[model samples]
Target: MPTVRVTRYVTPLREGGSLPGVVEAEDLGTYVCKFRGAGQGPRVLVAEVIVAGLARLLEIPTPDQVVLDVDPEIARYEADEEVQDLLNASAGLNLGIDFLPGAFGYDPISEPARDLAGRVLWLDALTANVDRSWRNPNLLVWRGVLYAIDHGASLYFHHSWPGGTGDPVRFAAQPYDASEHILRGYAAEARDQDVVLGKRLDDDALRSVLAEVCDDWLEPVPGAEDADALRERYVAFLRARLDGDRGWLPGEGAA
Candidate 1:
């Protein structure tokens, strides 16, 4: 991923608790930057990058990610005190996704193609993402293409890491309840895609994906001696879940 210096702080996204802002970078491109200082913390950004990597392997159309280097001096020019505070606090590397101008929020009034829906559902299930319900789909329609975003809420086990890296096997055994998934109608498609999807993320591919994350982004854990150890724990968790039995996998629903 490319790193860009923030040239301007545009606006706060009024919705999410993380207060991700629209910012202009030195590359003359606009991006939605997730602040490192957000209450949910850097772990969410780690999840975002890793999941985006997985989506890339699956051919999912997600926004290109970049690391935004924020400058504290820019905060003084901000009018909104809240956004100013966020900028002041996030004066270093933050998460940025290419801003899709005029993208509309996804509403599940109709179904998308089965294969695409299946790939999406499978990705969510594999990551244990619980956020993509109808109310907050976290999906966008840009230039008539569907794009996935905001994966910070996935990988629930990592929140326990301040104490220790939790058991990967327990996460592997955890069952996904897709009854309320935005793409629940295409559960069968997710299952069909699952046969080949897990194989796509072999050890090497997983390492490359984890490498996208910078060492500093990983929060320190009790037993984790360094960033490589922290990354290994994530890889171990993914391997366990991917190779585990399909018992937790969702069943078919109406097409």
Candidate 2:
């Protein structure tokens, strides 16, 4: 919603064995820049910008984030070649995310899996993030609720946009059926003021939020394929969920 400027480029942090640069944002506070090497890899910053911003609009619990212009001259950390190679080989070339010093870390939820169903459904339906599984523990439990992080791996099926028409992913538009676990979990947290959870998305809100956050980035990166195909796929996915039939609470929402 507000213009973000990258300022005070901080040293990089090694997470998942890659060097991700951290920068202080004059308006948004802090951000982690996933470095892009010469080789090919999914653009983590673009994913963050689209997914995190959209997640916020969908009322999902995501860490506040923004895209940052990186300064190679100011880069204070040297990446370990072996680690970089490994991440490059396994996770591809982009550097991992740079988080802030006070960013809170928490244990995963310990209750029945049902509590996380709504979250999983939201991640699947909207961001289409593939990382937040029970095994990966990408969802962090702080205080008493869940917060989502590490979305560097989603929308990978379509890497680049194709001249703006966009890729069509049928799953994007399908209604994400709430599992019994999701229904119970959302109901349990319905009264919890501190918890930021995803209620089912309606079509208009879903499209509006996606356009607001990702429309600009839908263009292809230089030297990369047009990103419009991917953008279309993402939009279609959101549309399917909104238009499809799904059970949702009356007024639960997040930002």
Candidate 3:
């Protein structure tokens, strides 16, 4: 992944609990950065990168993600004590989601084509992402293209790693309820692409996407000694989900 140095803290996006903020990078690009020091911690950042990588492989439109090298020194200029604490906590690498200028939040009134919407629904189900609800769509529209964002909520299993990274069999067999999904209206269309889409997640493709993830982001956890083991765990969980069961598929894999 490309690394960008944060030159300035633009503004805080207080809408979310993680307190994400817009900032300018050395590359002259702007990004909404997810702080590694946020209450949610670096796991959410890892989830963001892994899920977005999969989205790109699945041909789903999403913001470009990069690694932001943040310096705590910038926090000194901020007036808000709360914001200052957050900046000071997130001292090193953080996740930077490309800021889409003029992008509008998604609404049912401007739904995408059935196939595109269904594809998104399908991807969310596969990842067990529960964040794409109508209450917080996390979907954006720019230039008429629907883009998925804020994937930190996608992989929830990692939070349980304090006990040790358990076997992925359960995650693979897990079922996803799409009743509250923002694109639930297109669930049926998503079913049609299930088989074809599953085929695209071959080992090679999965590895390619995983390669984009930075080693620093893969914090070691029980059952995974090193970053390579951590990557394998992610790969194993995904491959198992694709091959283990279709329980997570929307409509129970009906096409």
Model 3 lDDT tens row, 1-255: 899999999999998999999999999999999999996798899889888988887788999988999999999999988889999999989989999999999988875988888889988988889898889999999998999898888878888876788878999989898888889888788888999888989998888877877787788888998888888888888888999768887884332
Summarize candidate 2's per-residue lDDT along 57-114 as a digit string, tens digits: 5455766654444344333343545433433332212222335354455443455344
Task: State every prediction's TM-score relative to the real structure.
Answer: 0.97, 0.58, 0.96
- lDDT pick, better of 1 and 3: 1
Error of 1 at 34 (Å): 0.4
In terms of TM-score, which candidate is stronger, 1 or 2?
A: 1
- The ten-residue window of minimal lDDT in model 1 covers 246-255
Which lDDT tens digits does candidate 1 get at residues 1-255?
889999988888978888898999999999999989887888999999999999999988899999999999999998888888888888899999999999999878855667988898889988999999888899999998889999998888889999999789999999988888888787887888787988899999999999999787997798786899999999999999988996667876423
Candidate 3 global CA lDDT score: 0.88
Q: Which candidate number would show the highest lDDT if scored against the true structure? A: 1
For residue 159, give model 3's deviation from the true position in Å: 0.9
Q: Could you report the Cα RMSD, in angstroms, for every candidate shown?
A: 1.3, 7.6, 1.7
lDDT ranking of the models: 1, 3, 2
